[model samples]
Target: MKVKVNRHAAKALKKMLEEAGAEGKLFRVYVTSVHGDHAHYDLKLDTPTENDEVVKSDKEIDFILDKNDEYLDDIWIQFFHVPNEEWLITNPSKGGHHHHH
Candidate 1:
């Protein structure tokens, strides 16, 4: 299991954590639902539960991932600036799926 967080995403996430007073909280990325081969992502600041994989980052943040979710592996989080500023979460392991925003 691998999770990569880019610089832009790390900065943005730091700000979010600071603003929400959620420092030291676990940044959890999980599969909210799965439709066929596509899986949706959900992020939240919460406590770690049993059977969670902790991903390491450069900053003082804790990333908790469920060990049971194979679909959440190899996740790449990046901030895009083409059309607008938004966070794009892509799972290269899961073929491809178009997301309309």
Candidate 2:
């Protein structure tokens, strides 16, 4: 499994992880819904579980993904500040559509 985080998202996530009560938790990217070809993804602060795979991004942040989920692999997590502040999670290997969070 592989996870990619943009610089902006890395900074934002790092800030989030530094918040109160986020000590030992890592970011978890989960599938919220699955449409025919693609899936929707959401993030949360969580710990690794038996069924999870902890993938480290180039930004040095670790993400938890389901080991058996095909849609969870090769995910790209991005953040934008221009038009609006939002989180965009996409999987190019799947369908490459953006899901806002």
Candidate 3:
């Protein structure tokens, strides 16, 4: 499993982790739904379970992913603030279709 976080996302995620209640928790990227060749993903604060793999991003933030889900592998987490603040999660290995959150 691999996770990549863009510079903007890394900064935003760092702020999220600094929130008062986020202590001891890491970001978890899970499958919300699958659409044949692609899938939707969402993020949450969570700890690693036995079935989860903690993948470290370029920013040194850890992300929890399900070990058995191919859709969870090679995920790219990005954040943009130009048009509006939002999260864009995509799997380049899957098809590179952006899933917004």
Top candidate, metric lDDT: 2
Q: Which stretches of candidate 1 lie over 4 Å from their true place?
A: 58-61, 98-101
Show model 3 residue runs off by greater than 4 Å.
none
Q: List the residue pairs that clash in candidate 3.
A: none
TM-score of each: 0.82, 0.98, 0.97
Comparing 2 with 3 on TM-score, the higher-scoring candidate is 2
Report the candidate with higher TM-score, 1 versus 2.
2
**Per-residue lDDT of model 3, residues 46-80, tens digit only:** 99999999999878999999999999999999999
> What is candidate 3's CA lDDT for residue 49?
90
List clashing residue pairs in candidate 2: none
| Candidate 3 residue-wise lDDT at 51 | 96
Deviation of model 1 at 40, angstroms: 0.9
Scored by Cα lDDT, where does model 2 land? 0.95
